[model samples]
Target: MQARHFKETYSELLSLTDSVPERVWTGILIAGCLALPWVVGSYSLSFATLSLVMIVGVLGLNLLTGVCGLISLGHAGFMAVGAYGAGIAAADYGLSILPSMLIGGLIAAASSLLVGIPSLRLKGLYLAITTLAFTVISTHVILNTPEITRGSTGLFLPEPNFFGYELNTPQKYYLFCLATCVLFVLATLNIMRSRVGRAFIAIREQDIAAEMMGINLRRYKLLAFAISAFYTGVSGALFAYHIRYINVDTFGLTLSIEALGMIIVGGLGSIAGAIIGAIFMTLLPEAVRMFFELFATQLNGLFATRALELRGLIYGAIIILILRFQPEGLIKIWRECRRIWGNWPFRY
Candidate 1:
């Protein structure tokens, strides 16, 4: 069957309407996700919840690096700000879950100004290095401020309360994360479809051309940073609650690199790419561990001793392979499959 578009007018052609298949697929996915916790065990549910949190953070990076062409290496620093901010609010201030998360996100957005303003003049590698420096400074500050963040000792978070109900169970937390992830996804989609999103894309393609076309580079770039930071901050807050523990060491440079890899391997500038990439990367380590466990007798404890190194090696290799063969990322493969299915039985 060959799918055909028979729009009679330009408006119809340009409308962002979902085809029947797309709508049906989306509905099925939603149903499956909603039913996942009941079918899966606690460990699997925990993994899915973590994946959702990463999706939020990765989506933020996609907006900045993918859509706006601004490379950042201090994303984890912003996450730290959010996590600490939310942790302080919930733990020390006695605020509920929702308010603490919002406060954390807002504080992260404000802190982004420190780098966003500098981004007005910086580009490419310079901007990335500048962000990296911010991350270093952020960790130092968090570690030094023993009174506030408890320094290297770490901060403990209480169970999140939603409308007086304590989200103590893994299933409840998973549902909360899913709902939050869906909201952020919708927000990102809306942003990408709006004038701001167009401006970001224009800047990404050519800043000078965008400037000539009357786009305010200063405003949009800063806005991008703020929005991206907010998303990441909320993600950090979720992470803090998910684990109920956090320290400066938690938001390390490696975590930032991992987030960057998620966007790159998922497909830059695509929402579906962010989601797919997060899930794939999140599951990769677990898959490796499973393989090691399956071959424990043959390996004779070698994997147990050098698990981290082996995992990193395999992860880097897979990323390199993906870059070599599918530079456009996994989303490209998905689209190709969908296209093939749509055009099945029509050789021409």
Candidate 2:
């Protein structure tokens, strides 16, 4: 009787995965998201919130590199635009947080248009170099625009709100961030599985061939940039609100590289890969930090400050190792595991 009951439960759970419609799956995901903060511990909820924000950045970069097949080393500049915009709108303009975020996203998207239009015309290395140049320009602009960004001093942001309630607690903030990230992810999945997604894949596979097939390169390419920039901007706005502070140092070239590292390790061109990348990269540092704290107690001195430098070296080396051994990344390995499990009986 117990064996029968266990089989029944397993079958029921597995059937949910097979029988659920796409729309129903979305609704279920939404329901789960709403329940997450309540069910999970506060610390875990906070970590999930940060992971979701990282997902936003990863999604944007994925669109640019994975979909559009355009590499950008200046994505962090787009993020900076959103971050500072949120800060200024929240503090000086005294705007609502929702509108502040929207404003930041639109402005970031618009700014990318200028960068994308011309940069898209260039091919390969030239295009990457152009984007990198934009990063340099963005740094200079932030440093010089003291009247607006306040230079290196940074600015504080107003508290986020919903229905006149300040989302002051980590739980509240986590809910908002998680909701937005999930929304973005769902929208991205829908878009990627649509006609535009096909065009993106076509272009990625071969731009000239895609153009031959009647896909408009300029329009789609710009669309990719605009879409990507929009997501990054939203994430940046969320970051600003969560931290409630902003400066030039917050967004830089290092962040851009980190984004690349995440997508590469998680799986380039896969949304699942992007999310996996974000979670791993964001949490890994925290884990490393904890190790350093424990190590400091044992090693007694000098190790605490030196630990950060060691962390950087470790991060770089690990990335290199992952690329060398598993260039297809974590996503490919995940898919393989699923495939193997599905065909387990054939193994005999």
Candidate 3:
């Protein structure tokens, strides 16, 4: 095979090269997802839905920490706000799912201002600690406010009703989540391609140089927080509805850490990385469970009580190994494979 290039015109030059394969693969993937619910068991369908929801949240965090170079430990706190916001709107106000989700996202974005504004002057460990404090404070508030949030008892959400249809089944909810995930993924890609997205990358590379280039650090930073929070909030809303029950502990520090890990493992600042990372992390626990199950008879139930602990240990080890050997993340590995395939039969 010989490599060919066609660039006779400016438009042709600007257009995507070798796009047909990409389109074909994307179409196949989409079709598979659409047909997945009918083919898979209920548990698998539910797992897929959870993966999609996490993808939404991870994409938001990627925009903030990965693209904008903002460090946040309060992602779960923002998610809690969104969850409670949507939960309250639907449970109490009797609003529909769409409106409730919108309100939740808006509320989360507004709350992000409290942290975002202060973050303009903070960086690195200091910024991380600040966000951590915010998470602690948010958790405290949620716990104390029993009347609204239902506190430690948990809040029960009504069945998600979109228009006249009720998303009562796992398959229905999964489809809803899949649609939402696609929209957010597309939105993130567009944002990264736009002027604001360029500014975000510039700030991430070198704030001082970006400022010298007339980029407004404070404005873009704050905007990043707002947008990130909105994405997370909607994700929270979906979560609340998905489970139909949420407590403060549901959106705890563990979730924030997992979101951060997803971005790191997937490849920071890459949209596809976020999606891939979310899917991988979501399925990791199940993989661990399957491993234990496979050796259940041989282990003689020795690891039954310690499964959770072992899972965490294995998870940490895998992350360390990936960081040690492939610091660029799983996306780098993906790119390398693609490059090799594209250059098959010849090494340049």
Which residue pairs does candidate 3 place in steric collision?
none
lDDT (Cα, tens digit) per residue for candidate 1, span 1-348: 424567777876555554778778888998999999999999999899999999999999999999999999988999999999999999898888899999999999999999999778999999999999989998999999999999999999998998688998999999999999999998898899899999999999999999999999999999999999999999999999999999988999999999999999999999999999999999988987787788888986788689789877987898999989999999999999887778777624
Q: lDDT of all predictions, in order shown?
A: 0.92, 0.83, 0.90
What's the best-to-worst order under TM-score?
Answer: 1, 3, 2
- Give per-residue lDDT, candidate 3, residue 308: 82
Best by lDDT: 1
Any runs in candidate 3 off by more than 4 Å, and if so which? 1-18
* Residues 1-348 of candidate 3: C-alpha lDDT, one tens digit per residue: 535475567765544444677778888999999999999999888889999999999999999999999998888989999999999999999998899998999999999999988879899989988888888888999999999988899999999989769888888888988999989988887788789999999999999999999999989998999999999999999999988999988988988889999999999999989888999999988988898888888985778778788878988888899888988889999999888888876747
Backbone clashes in model 2:
0
For model 1, state the Cα shift of residue 257 in Å: 0.4
Model 1 alpha-carbon miss at residue 32, Å: 0.7
lDDT of 2 at 72: 85
TM-score of 1: 0.95
- Against the true structure, what is each candidate's TM-score? 0.95, 0.87, 0.95
Candidate 1 positional error at 183, Å: 0.6
